[model samples]
Target: MSTTPSTTPEVRDDSRPARIGIQLQPQHAQYPAIRAAAARVEEMGADIAFNWDHFYPLYGEPEGLHFECWTMLAAWAEATSRIEIGALVSCNSYRNPELLADMARTVDHISAHDAGTGRLVLGIGSGWFEKDYDEYGYEFGTAGGRLDKLRDDLPRIESRLGALNPAPTRKIPVLIGGGGEKKTLRLVAKHADIWHTFGDVETFTRKSAVLDERCAEIGRDPGEIERSVGVETVQDAETMFAAGARLFTIGVGGPDYDTAVLADLLAWRDDKNA
Candidate 1:
């Protein structure tokens, strides 16, 4: 799926202002508490809200008060009107591609309001987590195999979105998460509107250059995809932004869903944009 760089201009204008995102970790929090936190983050001026796709907690107790991803997203569609919502990266192996497309379309409609059309970024990636595979009876194939599946399914998901009776409210932006220099980055150059990955300034700079090379091969301007990264503090955000990350996300766990870290990052975003 190589797009000729000369033919495909940038999908997004990078000159746009930087934005902030919040990954309100679903583990260790009650449903009501999570709901409140989601709303509060939007009220606090977050540009987007993300939840992970996993059956169990990624940290702390293995078995904790974790909530399902898509279901919570559905509720968020109605619970909040201002903020966009989606999985940080929905595991491609967990659900059929067509079904996933339908689910996204439904949520897109649900989230659509007078303020705007439905906001759902179709963030997806190959599945990981052996526990999720074992307990759910999903195939925990080799990493390459999973990547192959993801490569095959993305086009199908797009096709399904086009074939739906009522299409998505807007062109759902595809956010592909991962930093695999080979297959993963290639897919991002071909399919993703936003690319999310993690690494320090040096690592990010190297991988980002690789991504641009991939885009050039396919004929798409590297700037077409927005660069996003997870940050633990304002300092990390500064480093990543200096390396070209435009979307900064902060993840917080639990019962309280602390927003202190988010406050600092948000302020940083304002300062940068200002």
Candidate 2:
């Protein structure tokens, strides 16, 4: 993972316009509330709606109400019309990669009811969350090991997507989340159609440079992958946008998934794109 600068041309195009995403963290709230919030965000003009992949709550009461990611996404596929639906990053270890591919394809079809193209973004990453691993009986291996698994399984998932009986309605976009410069960025360079991570502008710029280096090493144009940042405010989004990020997302915890600010951000998105 040496950062020795490459002489390759800078083809990492970050010229894409900004789009807003909301992570309605499936925690603290009941199913009805989560469902309603998903529908509401679609109504509010979000470009993407994401939930997280975890067995338990990430914050607030650890045992508070929470829901699974994929099943909820299936419901979202039926519940919403326009906004794209997915986990922010599905844990690669939770389900078999082939099975996960099938699930994604099915959800893709479900979401493509109106238009013939699925709105499912297959956002995935190596598993984290010790509780999710322990409670679900998954082997919580070392971080490196889990990443290795993700790297290996991604191709299988892709192959399975190709082999599915009826075939996915469209080529489902693969969004990989994480910023591990050594391994994650390289995997992202190889497989991701969208790359997501959380950091300030400086961190994003630095890691994005490393991502550029990774893509150059493999002869892939980094611009092919969208840049997604998990942001909390307009200022954060603005700074990252200035630094070449196109997708900005906010996380809203449940009980009450307040998203009034999302309207403001959506306005910002429109302004940027305009």
Candidate 3:
């Protein structure tokens, strides 16, 4: 198998539009509600939609309604007509890197079928949900150690992608989430096409500086990595945009899967693009 560069691999700009995405948290909602939210977000002109990779809900209640990540992504692929879909950040610990690549490739094909527009952005991060590790029986180690594995495995994942029978119709964009200055941002500089983080404008500005330094240290251009931030409302949207964040993600929860907030986000997206 051909081993691709483990760090800072070249990415082709595929003419995908820049816009907003929402992480449809699987906690409180049922499948029907989640499907409706996906349809509504696409109709509102959001460019992408996402879900978290966790066995249980991250918030609300620990044992609340939840869905698996890759499986749910396959469903989203079939359910939506326009928006790009993937996990906001899939946990790397859950699956072997090669297997994850194959799964992503399969979903990429599923999304592209008949529609001709297939997009899957693999947003991955060092696994952090302790309950998931405990329930699934995977060892929860030091954060640094998990990030180390991520750094080592990224190239392997890319290498395996080339060997898959039907290569993904398009080059999959790798999105790394987290803002750990010592390792996470460094990994972002080295491996990610998109870097996502959660914070306010001040926090984001500070972390961006650290990420820039990491890029310089690694001999990579910081601008090559798309800066993404999670937004909760329109005010946060404007703040993040002003602070140099080009990609904004809002999160909506399940069961009720409301889109009232999404309407405002879409208006802001149009204003920025207009």
Candidate 4:
């Protein structure tokens, strides 16, 4: 399989003010609420929608209501038309790199067939949730070890796509989430088309500078990698954007998935496009 960039058509608008993606957190929500929230986000003009691949909620209650990631994305792909869908960061430890590539490819096909848009931006990260590993019978190792595995596996994952019987109609964009400067950022500079970090404007600004330095060392242009950040409140949106965060993600938990807060974000996105 050739490692060169696939000839798939570029389907995203790179000029837009980054993009506003919502993480449909698998917690405190039910199926209907999650489904409705996806629809509302699409209606409100969100560019992308996402869910995390975890067995439990990351916040609120430890064992709160939750849903699985890939399964939910398959549903969201069918539920909405105009918004891209994916996991905020699928854990690299859960599945084999080849299998994961196939899964992502299948989802890409589903999104294209259902919505007429093959927009599956895969946001992947080194495994973190210890509870998930314990419950799933996987080993819980040091953070460095996990990241090493990810670095080793990413290229294989990319290569596997070419080996698949029917190639994905699009080359799914790979978004690597995490801000560890030494290891993670280097991996981002080398492999990621998008890099997602968590923090306020000041934090993102600092880390982004480090990322740029790493990019230089790797002979990669920092501008080539899209910078993304998670927004818990609307007020931080403009602040982060000004700090060089083009991709802003808002997380909405389940059960009562409300999109009221997303209205401001969508409006902001539209303003930029307009």
lDDT, candidate 3, residue 197? 94
lDDT of 4 by residue, 27-63 (tens): 8877888888888888877888989999988999998
Clashing pairs in 4: 28-254, 29-254, 29-255, 30-255
TM-score of each: 0.94, 0.95, 0.91, 0.90
Runs with alpha carbons beyond 4 Å of true place in candidate 4? 1-16, 114-117
Q: Considering only N, C-alpha and C atoms within 3 Å, which residue pairs clash in candidate 2? A: none
Model 2 over residues 26-56: C-alpha lDDT tens digits?
A: 9999999999999999999999999999999
TM-score of 1: 0.94
lDDT of 1 by residue, 1-274 (tens): 4332232122333585788999988999899999999989999999999999999999999999999999999999999988889999899999999999999999999899664699888899998888999999999989999999999999999999999978888999999999998899999999999999997777777777778889989899997899999989998988777667899898888899999988888888899999
C-alpha lDDT of residue 119 in model 1: 85
lDDT by candidate, in order shown: 0.89, 0.91, 0.84, 0.83
Off by over 4 Å in 1: 1-13
Worst 10-residue lDDT window for candidate 3 reads 1-10
Error of model 3, residue 86, in angstroms: 0.9
What local lDDT score does residue 174 receive in model 4, on the 0 to 100 scale? 92
